[model samples]
Each structure stands twice: as C-alpha cells, then as structure tokens.
Target chain A: MKLRDFVLRRIILAIPVIFGVLTITWFLSYVVGDPLAMYVTERTPDAAIPGIIRARGLDAPLVVQYFLYLTALFQGDWGVSTTTGADQPVLTVLARLFPATIELSIVAMSIAIVLGIPLGIISATRKDKAADHVTRVFALIGVSMPIFWFGLMLKYVLFYQLSVWDLPHLPGGDRYNFRAFGSWQPTTGFLLIDSLLFEHNPALFLDAVVHLIMPAFCLGYITLAIITRMMRSSMLEVIKEDYITLAKSKGLSERVVIYKHALRNALIPTVTVIGLAFGGLITGAVLTETIFNWPGLGRWATNSILNSDIAAINGFTLLVAFIFVIANFIVDMIYGVLDPRIRFG
Target chain B: MSDELVLHVKDLYVNFYTYEGIVKALDGVEMFLRRGDTMGVVGETGCGKSVTAKSILRLIEAPGRLDDGQILFFDQDFETKETIELDLAKLELEEMLEIRGNRISIVFQDPATYPNPVFRIGDQIAEVIELHQNLAMDVLYMKIAKLELTLSEATSDENRAEIEGKISYYRQQLDDPPEPDKKSMREAAKLKAIEMLRLVRMPAPEQVVNQYPHELSGGMRQRALIAMSLACNPSILICDEATTALDVTVQAQVLLLLNQLKAEIGTSIIVITHDMGVVAETCNWVNVMYAGTTVESCATEEIFAKPLHPYTAGLLIAVPKLHEVKDRLPQIRGTVPNLITPPTGCRFHPRCDYATSVCKEKKPLLEELEPGHWVACHHPLRS
Candidate 1:
C-alpha cells in the first residue's frame, strides 16, 4: 500500500474503536451513580423527583438515551455541564483542555525520546563496559523514584524556599501578579513567549525557559529512563542477527549499522513501552500534576471527581478514552511500518 | 590460480571465552577462495562453516579470540597484494570497513531475515547505490535510468525544475501524490531492485518490489536476498547455507540461479552448506570441515574420485547417493564433539574409523596427496 493510504486506512479503523469507547462511557455514566439525582433532583423534594426526571428526559428508555446521545453528537452538542450551570459545551471544554494536556504529554515524551533513544544506542553499543553500567545505574535510580515526590522535591528545592533563581510561579496553573513584572509585561497564555513579548528580547524567554528546566525535566526523566532501558535491550537482540552481521560486513559505519539497520528493526518492541510512557503523560501523572499545581488533564480529572461533577468526569473520561484509542491506533500503524508482516484493512 | 587467489586463510583459530573454559570454534583452519570460482564449503552442524564465513569479514565479537589468519582482497595490485590474510589483529576498523561489503558481500540463509523489515526494499538497494556510485546528480540519474532502459522527459531542465518542485513537496509529504507523482528517486531504486529480482529469475519481479518480506514465499525471499547481495556486484559473494532451508526442488532452482549469477558476474562464491549433493552439483572446488578445522580441500572431481582423509571418506560414505541405493546408509559414529572444550589433538579422532594412537596424538595439517588434492589424515600417504 502507498504510505498515505496506509495512514488513512488506520484512521478509518480507529472510528469504530472511538465509537465503542464513547458508547461505553455513556453506559457507565448511568450505571455508576444516579445521574438523575446528581444532575437534577438530589436537592429537589422527593415528590418533585419524578417531575424533574420527566422534565429533563431521564425518564426515557435506555436505548432512547443512547440514540439521543448519538443524535446530540451529530448536532454538534456534547451535552452540558450539569454542575456549574456554566453553559459550557463538552467540546468546548475538551478543545480548551486538550492542548494543555497534549503540551504536557509532548513535554514528558520529549524527555523520554531525547534521553531514551541515545541512552539506548550508547548502552547497547558499550554492552558490558563502564558506560553501560553507569546508564543502568542512573536508569534504575530514575525508575525507582516516585514522580510526584520527585516533582514536589524539585519544586521545593528549586522554586519555593531558598529561591534558587525563583522560577516564575507555574505558568497558567499558578497565576503570578502582573504588577510584579514592574517595568516589563508581556501578553500570551504561554509564559515563555509572553515574558519575551514585552521587550522583544530572549533574556525573559530564557528566564521562563530556565524555569521550565526543572519541572519539564522532572516530568520527562523517569519515562526517559524506562524507554532507554527498553530500547537498549531490544537493540542488543537485533544486533546479534546474521543480517546485522551482513550489514556490518557491508562496511557500514558501526553507528550506521546499529541505528539504521539494527535499531530501526529493534524499535518494534520498544515502541510499546514508549507508548505506555506517553499514555502515562496524557492521563496525567496525578502526583506530578498535583505537586506542580499544573492545571492539566490530570488535575482537571481530579477536581471533577472531588466536586462530584458527572458532566466533567464523563467528559474527562471520554477525552482520555479518545487519546488512548488514537495513541493505540498510531502505535498499530507504526507496527505495520516497522514489521510489514502485519496487514489490516 | 595466482591471479584468482583473492582470499587465503592460514591456521585461523577462533576461541570464545566462556565460564567453563575457552570454546575453540575454529582451530587452525586453512581455507582459500579464488576469484571467479564457486567454492562450496560443506560440513555437518557445529562444524564451523559459519565461523569460517564470519572470519572473512572479521565479524566475530569479543570473547571470541581470533587466535590467527589472513584474508586478502582484490586491491589495486591485483597480484600478491590482493591476497590479504584473514588476520583480525592486523587490520583496523577503517581497513575492515573498506573490505567488508565493498569487496565481499554475504547472502545469508533466510532472505526475509536479511533486509531490515522496516525499510522499503527500494530504500535498502538505493542506499548501497548511493554509497558506492559517487556520481553527479544528472549523470547518476542517467546511469540508473539507463539500467531500466528508459530515460524520462522529466530529466529535461524545464521538466527537472517541475520535478524538483514536486520532490520538495514529496519531502514535505503534503498530501498523497498521484501515481505519476511517485518519487522517481525511490522508483529508480525500486526499478533496480526489481531488475535484480528478475535477474535471479523470480517471477513477477514488479509484483514483489513493494511487498514486504513476509509477502514473498521463502524461495522468493531467498531470491530477493540474492538480489540484495548482488546489489554491489560484489567481487566475492558468501552464501552461508544459502539453500539449506529450501526443499529439494527449490534448492536446485536456487543453486542454478547462484551458478548463473556466478557465471554472469564473474564473482567468486563461497557456498556454505551441509548438503554434499549440492556441493557435488554446484561447486567446482570443495572444502570439508570437521569440528572447526578443514580436514580436506581439493578439486571436486579429484576428491570425489580419490577421497583421502578418514573424516572426508567417512562423510562421503555416510550418505547414500541417489544412483547408488543401499540397504543401510553408512553412518559416521559419534556426534560432533562439544565446542566449549573440544577433544584435544585431532577433534574428529573419536568418530574416525582410522583413529590409531598416532591419529589421536596429533592433529594433521592438509598435505598434498595428489595434484590439487589436500587431505588432513595420518593415512593420506596410504591413499
């Protein structure tokens, strides 16, 4: 198949999976807690419960609710926020929140990819040498530490008390006093860019980026350690194959043989672990999100649960479900790219 | 023989360090492959046929000590200088790199296992061309384009600019290109690989180009690997058990293809196999290895007519020839000795019918018993 066709085909395969997920989310919404009581009648008098249920259409049959939900989706409605009376649409919440979640996940995964791939290649190449031992030791340390505790420790040491370069209060999540900027001010939701906007100088961007140094590092490191170890193990296996020996015999540079011929083939197995690390990022390392006070999907999901806001919870669940399905679909398409033995319409 | 002596290995020893002791894999093995000749090296399993092939390119890893050897290549001199000993200690990484794929290429057992699964066959073939054929853009295009027997109007300057624009967009992967818009560079590589596939007599060469390894049958995949191996028109091709996995019918076909390839390209071939029949049919010269050492080496007709080495004689009689049906195929007694701590003196002594105290006391070197026939045995003088 042409590469473009392969991608489009994968997207089409994801449709049913996406639909199935939303359907399950919808079913579980009803099964979990009394949505009728939660949304409309928990505060209402007992005599008025039926009238309230009837008014809001909950008294309708289950299949009817399902059909209505499907219909509402087609009409560009993702249902309403039943708790806040905010009139915000589920799509609107998702559109606003998805970027933040993606950005965080991207940051965490950037850490995994940047650190993991090289560490893996180096460790595999070195094998039983000292470099391999050092990487293994560091990877063990990174994997053993709890992300939340790590994040909190980073915040405490780097930001709060001694004020080591007093990093700007966590951007967006921790709102800083604009007046504190004194002679300089900037506009934009992204703090690094905003800090650079006023003076059109990179110093402020650097300062903001410098602040980004710790939190993003903390967020991405552990996953990097995980993916690196996985990549190293897989790379070692591929290097042993006769074809790899053939590749080396071809006079390919040792680096080229390992990366181009060996690692690309070996990457098939490591992809799954890296994928899990990505999902961990998206769903939120709850502790990391909480410790850093980063108002991302993880925090959003937690607050909704505490507030007992069914609409918010369901929206978050469905959003997470969407990310999970799409990530796996991407992983599958990548699998086909890597192995070529897999074929699916 | 003087001009064609491309590789000469003398007393090649490969020892691997293990917990119990050093594993002697290849023990003082002497081997030689001349240019333009297909030399079949046959031995039973664990007999170090693979170790010998790997030793040519110096592919053995650490813990595997290359105790000795010389592997000569086709260099500028084309005479004695061309013959480099297959010594792991003498060459550096840079020297080995120049020799490995450029001078010699290897086609392994499974074609499917050869090309990396992720890359398109086109990219894989094109990479070899890109590295080896250092030519300017248009000239390179014409050279490759000529091989396909047609040059597109797209090579014209006005058309070239247009194509470059399309290529830029392709690099971006903006959207799906139409059929005519497929990357010509990629298509060029595909054309080359397909041409190779056709050269090896794989049917529907065009059909298998875009297909992955698994899509091709085992025989076809082996053919594709041969196609890849010949990508550089390598002076020496190592077929490491090239037909071992194939059935008899397919094996014959692949052997025919190898013979044809050798004739057409005039490249020396090292056919590594355990199949004596294949050696008889496909090889002009043969090396019989026993427990990591070459016990006999001779011209095919000479060895078949007057086998000398006890192991070689035993190996010859062990299998029944299709024409000479017998009630019981003669068996060579005793399994191959453990390589980790191989038996001292002659490794094959326990299995040899002629193992006297003298035979067990010393390992014999290949001694000329007749014109062009060398045998390693205490009794070769009698033969």
Candidate 2:
C-alpha cells in the first residue's frame, strides 16, 4: 500500500503498454512491402535498387528486422527519414520538433486550468442563475466549434482585421522570429525558455509569446469547455453530499465548504480529464501546428505519414504512447492526494 | 443549574419549496432547553426532528427557508456582564459566525460524513480551535507597521535602541513565537484539540490525531466527531441523530460518552432522534413530534408513566418490550402523512384509533394538563 511501490507498479505496467504500441506501429509501418518506397521512383537506375535495400536492412527476415528495430530503439537510433534523402536520424528530427508541441500544450493547458475550474465553481454555486446560463452557452459553443475552423477564424480576426485596425501585426503560425535566431541553437528545446535564456533575446521571447496565444487558445478552448462542464456537474453532485452539510454545520465559511470540502472531491474526475486532454493536445497538435506552421512533432509526423517515412512514423507513435501512459500515472497519483479512500496497494 | 434557560424556540416554521409542493417541515414547533439538561426531540421519520435542530442553527439553505421562528439563545455578554438574548433567525452572517462554533456546535448523524476525508483528525479539530480562539496581539502586522512608522518618524537617536528592541520583540512573536505566548498560539490550539480528544476517551489521542478519518473505525469516527465538536467548549451541542448510524454497542458507548460529557462540560444538548430507547435512557425531557408539530412535551418518566396524547401512547405500545409476551410486535397503523397536504385538524387524527369528530374537525394545541406535563389531545387519558 506504500506510495512508492504503487508508483513502481504503475511504471512496470506501462512497459507492456509501450511495447504493444511500438509493435503495432512497427508492424503497420515496416511489414507493408518496402520501407524504401518513398525513396524509390521510376528511374533508369534499376541496378542500384538492390544495393539501397540491402543498405537499409530490408533484406533481413521479419523476426530479425523486429529484433533489430527493438535493439536500434534501445540504442536511441530511430532510423533515417526517406523523404529528405539527407540521411537525418528520426530521433534527432523528433527531438528538434517535440519541444514546440510540449510548449504549446503546456500554455494551452495552463489557460484551460486557469479559466476552467473557477468558472465551473461559479457556475455550480450560482446554479440555474444568469451566470450559470452564460457559462453553459459559452461551453456549448466552445465544445461544438471545429478546432480547424476556429483556428482559421482566430487568425483572420486577431492577426488580419485587428492588425488592420491599428494594432501591431500579431505573430502567427511560426515558432519564433527565425530571422533573429537563424541557427537552431538547441538549448532547452522549449522555444519560449530557449529564446529568453539561450538566445539572450527578450524580443524573441515576447515575439514567441505573441505567436503562441492564438493557436494555444484554439487548442485549449475544447479542454476548457469540457473541464468546466465536468467541474460544474461534479461540484453540484459533491455539494449535495452529507459531508458538505457537515462542513457547513461546523460553521466553516461557504468558501471552505465549496472549495476545500466539495471541490477537492469534485476535482478527482477533472484531473483525469485534464491528463487525458493533455495527451490529446499532443496528438491534436498536428492540425493546430499545420494551421499555425508550428514546427512540432505533430506536423513532422503528418508530413512523414504523407511521404511514407516509416521510421519517423514509428518513433512518433511510440513517443506519444509513452507520454499518454505517464500522464495517466500522474493522474492516479493526484487522485490519491485528493481522496484518502483510494489507497494504492 | 438546570433552571437556567440556554435555548428557547417559539413557533418555529421551516418550509422546503420543492417541485412537488412546499413541505412545511417544521410548522410552529416549540422547545426549550436548560443548562446541563439533555432534551430529546423524539419523533418518527419525516416528523421534522432534524428540521427543528437545523432551524435553530439557521442552517436551512435555499429552497428551504426558515419562514417564521424565533430562536432566542441566552449567553453571557462578557463586556456587559449580563446574559443577552440573541435572536438567531435575525442575526446576520458575521455575528452568526462568532456564535456558531464558539457558543454552539453540532455533531451530525453519520460520523463518516462529518470529518473531511483528505485531512487528518488533528487538522480538522485544530481548524475549529484556530477559528474560535483569539489570542492577544493576534491583530499582528498592521500594528507592527504603525509602530515601525512611528519609530522611523522619531528624530531622537537616544530612544532608538528601545524602539528597535520593541520592534524586534513584535517581529519575533510574528515569526517564531515563544512558548505560552501569542507566538505559540497555533501550537496551543493543537494542544487544546488533542486535550479534547483525550476528554472523549480516544485511546492514544496522539497517534489518532495524526491519522485520517478513513484510518479509523465507525466508533472511533463518532468519538472523533464528538471530540471535534466539543473542542470549543460550546455552551450547547446539537446531536442530530448522533448515534443512529453506529452499531448497538458503539451506540451505547457513545450515549454514555455524551452523558459523561454533559456532566463534565455542563453543556446543554438537543438530541434529535427517532429511537425511544435513546430518549428513555439519556434525555431529561422528551418532546414528541408528529407532522412538523410537537404533540406532547413532558419529563421522560412522566411521559412514559401517564401518556396523555393518543399518539404518544401508540408510540410507547409500538416499542417491543422484553417482559411482554406476544406472537407479533405491535406497530402503529399507517405511515407518516404527506406534510405538503397534511391531514386537517390534528395531523395524527387519520391514524388515531380513538379519533373523534372533534379530533378530525379541530387541531388541539399543546396545553399543560399537569404542572410539568403538556399534551395536544381532545380525549385526554384520566387516571
């Protein structure tokens, strides 16, 4: 029942999950005919094809190739991208792009959490009032709107029309001011932090923040809506509990009864949603990144998939799967903190 | 000691507005308690016992309003050196907060629901202590700031060290307070909470204080709840079905504890329960309720000895006795009437076997038949 042992057990359980994800991605990407299909074309150099296939280890048996993939994966060799033809390792490419998605997801999740929980509490406390109705309408619109369309509309409004109306041209689509920081000076990988700390450019940091707002809002709106609705309903249910009555009977302030007593228990479900949503944000970054021209893993993965870049696709799936498992593990730990009933064995 | 009135409720009415109808939960219910006396509000389910208790505290939230009532709480006003009557129903929230946990406290039905599960028992008890306990120099920082400003404005260098020393003393008390002083106020509060636990006979109060509510058994939880409620040394403690959720053995133990507490702390108690046995054993006075109205009020022995109200007689007969021989236990006919459209006249007329034309046409008010006994009935039992 110890917390450390519980955590260790969860980590052990995640191994099989990671392996399953990697195996599925490997079989789907590698087993389908040629790994070098994207590199091949109807050219006159037919004799060089066998040499290229042998060079890429496509000549090995299926089982041997699986073991080789696992070994190379353990050794941090994620194979090479076939689309660029520059022999760039998938690991290095993904490493370069992953932080942009992480930064975006962090900002987006922060916005969701900051706005969602209090709004939900307000909606619950003022149930059936004007405040509740307004929040419900806002949540409905936020949930129903398509993210892609929402992103484009945001760009059109804030970046285009708003800029024309005498505002500074808001940064959009790009990660940072590429002109100022020309070389990809890898520091912390997170552009916001790297721009400030590594690049030593406050302008770049401010510019990155400006560019981040629109896409972050577009991505975060759905999570905010879902969290708000969840919190409202959960708070409503928890507030009706006898514990809440007992809390008020103790003459504790209404704030303490609602937040300290009801909200802590209500938030158990919200934590689960937040964790799952964070993982979804990572995968969902593909569409957001494409619209915003963010050079993150999602955009890279989409490009790789279109080009049949097998190695890049495999690495991306495994990485996302690992992050998902870790997020769920963290949520479980938070549940233990929130409710004393859920003791781990 | 018993003659000193602690709480007096007159014509208290509580109504719950629901989609179905407005439930007149407590319709003109009246009761009074004296110092160190335990008064039991005995009634069947849906008889407004809990409602009456909640109304006294003005804890009836939205959709359920304290429609009309006067809860006159008598307490000593320290500054005035006289007992003051507080109309709890009219008191604003700020004033209510001062009286709620300090002068009056409550022990709820289910012990499991009383303590917040996330916090340790020590923290829960300590919170109440910290809320009620006001230490001298507790109005910290602002006074210190004003003193610092005065020290700064002073042009003389001669008295600078003395002023500086005074500032440092206040600062030390603000930061790491010394023992037996304003600085160690929180520690003192925690110690008081633990002392309360010890008073409730919680074994190894030191270890139990650190554990969460889930770590304790049902009996322990109830004991902890009692401990938490008594931490402020409240003048009146309301036990709203305090022992109903526990097993029989634990129930007896808890009742014994409450009796011991009443003797030791001299706190008047309002025991709201449906259990007649609990009333017979623990209560000094019994008030029988039916459909949100008190049908009978008398001393426990007097009510049992010469039951005047037909409803009270029915309740006494319904209780299964060990010495009596019967194939099947006697039970009262029919269920509790719908309070929203409650029976006209006497609410119990429909279920009363001795219901007369007078009983059906007119409601009998609670009237004193003897010196210490009161009953609401048209057909009074003659001895």
DockQ of each: 0.49, 0.57
What value does the lDDT take at residue B76 in candidate 2?
70
Runs with alpha carbons beyond 4 Å of true place in candidate 2: A31-34, A179-184, B78-81, B135-183
Against the true structure, candidate 2 has what lDDT?
0.86
> Could you tell me how far off, in angstroms, the CA of residue A21 lies in candidate 1 after the best superposition?
3.4
Model 1: TM-score, first chain: 0.82
Candidate 1: tens digits of C-alpha lDDT, residues A1-345: 576787787788778877887788778767776776455434667888778688767889999978988888779777766443465776776665565456556766887788888898899999999999999998988899988777777677656654546654434223222354444442434555556665676765565455455556777888889888998998898898866876776678887888788987888888888776677777655566666565456666676666566667767777776677677777877877677666453
Instruction: Point to the candidate with the largest DockQ.
Output: 2
lDDT of 2 by residue, A171-216 (tens): 6679877786675687889878887888888887888898899899
Docking class of 2: medium
Q: For this target, which candidate reaches the highest lDDT against the unseen true structure?
A: 2
Candidate 2 chain B weakest ten by summed lDDT: B134-143
